[model samples]
Target: MKFATTLSLLLLLSSILVCTMSTPLSRRHSLSVIRKLNREGPFVGLITVYAPEENAFLASNAFKPDPRHPFVDLSGRRFRIGKVRGKGVVYVRCGVGLRNAVAATQQMLDLFNVSGVIHFGIAGSLENSLRTGYVSIPKQFAQTGLWEWLKANGTVGPEYFAHLDIGSYNVPEGEGINQLGHIGYSAEEFYSESGVPNVPRRVVWANVSQNWYNIATKLEGMELERCLNSTVCLPQVPKVVIGQRGSTANIFVDNSAYRDFLSKTLGVSLAEMESASVIMTSVANGFPVIVIRGLSDAAGGQDGPNSARALGPLAALNTAKVVIRFIELLPSHKKYQDLK
Candidate 1:
């Protein structure tokens, strides 16, 4: 009886161990683990917000999916945007913020067996030089609870983080293709009015120039200044800048506390509704992501001729071009093209 009882206990213990091992650490993290299980090579996933305005931007060009591309579900969940060969990168529009971003990212990881993820979307500028039409890559990301949480759960730790070993995709000396980036926060507010001047350390930031034009024009007299400003399309752009961009969930332009939060925490030049969620989720998932935003409004200003709704698509189009440029220069894609 003792032997039989002992044997039964051992079997039960073994079953429990198996179950524990099978269970994922967090509900949100299962996608990464599943991705690890189905390893192939060189496939990258792109995430964007799924808004009607954003779709309008994408409508200008319908990027096709690669039949051989593993993640092209055709269910609209995942679509392919042509094959760059050896590098089978795909573009997908996941909804906005943390919850949507997390779901979209995981879906990409699980569905396509992609090797990495890249994010292309609009971000308000946080630097002066980064006008409405310019673009910025975030070198170091900043935020509140989001960053802290990602450090605890992601490949990049609390001190600072990045998933890929990104090097310059150099075009030439004083030339076209460059590895530009910046340090900015994905925050939850817009327009810092705490009376504390929100200033950013000298870090290069990227943002689309046209969007900057939209907002800067709202600043009392900026409307006329834009026509005379050529920096709007400067020849040599920096990796980043602090523009007139700040963001918030609610568009309460009268809130003093919210503005202070933007100044103190985000150091925002322009205000928008997304970025923080994207950075948090991307970092957590261990995906090598890039943020490309177009300035649709100047910091602490009203909407000009183009509202967020109108400007989103144009920004997406410009950003898409940049994404394509990066893909073209990728080593895998280059080699694949050479064979052809």
Candidate 2:
């Protein structure tokens, strides 16, 4: 849900709270970057996680640049200020991992008069049916990295993923699953920021904007890339499946057992490292956002070697295709016009 302006202001008071100190680092950073750039727009933020993904987006024919100043620099980062499908867009590579994603996205929003955000990149498929090269525009994203290390005297959470939900993920914590030594995955808690005063909020899923989801849904059944090259092809044709819940974690998932745990517990179709942060930040600021992920591997369950080694570039290219199409279709939408 988008945070209300009144509630957003109230959150500043948290700096004086006893549970924590100071405002969220993103808020402070936002003020500084906005003051510095001081730009205007209804510009949509296009963010990607690393070079391969960014490069693919750049190569798209849809990335039409503003001839006068197609590129700009901010604090050593290069951002492409352009148009996608005739909609104003500012694209940047938000390096890998959760923290990097949060920082880079916040900077982009701060530097431009951004109306919304679109983040896309490669992912490891958590669902076996979602083969390598398939693109997933998940309706919701969850940060799976947040957890509580339950020890021998453990109790089920009011704070974390339930004991029943995370039981399979528990390692041999010096004893059996009944003991507190296991790790319990948890929902990330948002205090005061949830917009209701004095309430510490927790969520099982963070959502993307429905309007964006409506636009993205049109891409379903659109053709996807199925081959890395003539000979190196995926088992079958790639597809764009929308609305499945996806997940993210700072850790790269390469083990099948861990992947199964996430899929069963979270109903995740795809898993990656950065999009959850982007969605959370955008939601906090009341901007529409969406994440598109292409499966590069099967989260360690692929028949052969992890497909990402040879499949990353190909998967990224497919996501770029979907994103570009989405942007092209975005122009003149009732929702975006409201932003202007």
RMSD of each: 16.5, 8.7
Local error of candidate 1 at residue 269 (angstroms): 3.8
Rate residue 43 of model 2 by lDDT.
79
Q: Which ten residues in a row have the lowest lDDT in candidate 1?
A: 219-228
| Clashes per candidate, residues 3 or more apart or on different chains | 54, 7
Summarize candidate 1's per-residue lDDT along 228-248 as a digit string, tens digits.
133233233323232333342
Would you estimate the TM-scores of all the predictions?
A: 0.50, 0.81
Q: What does candidate 1 score on TM?
A: 0.50
lDDT tens per residue, model 2, 216-330? 8989899887876787787799999988888788888888887887788678888889988998888776778989998999987766688786889999999999988888777
Candidate 2, position 259, lDDT: 81
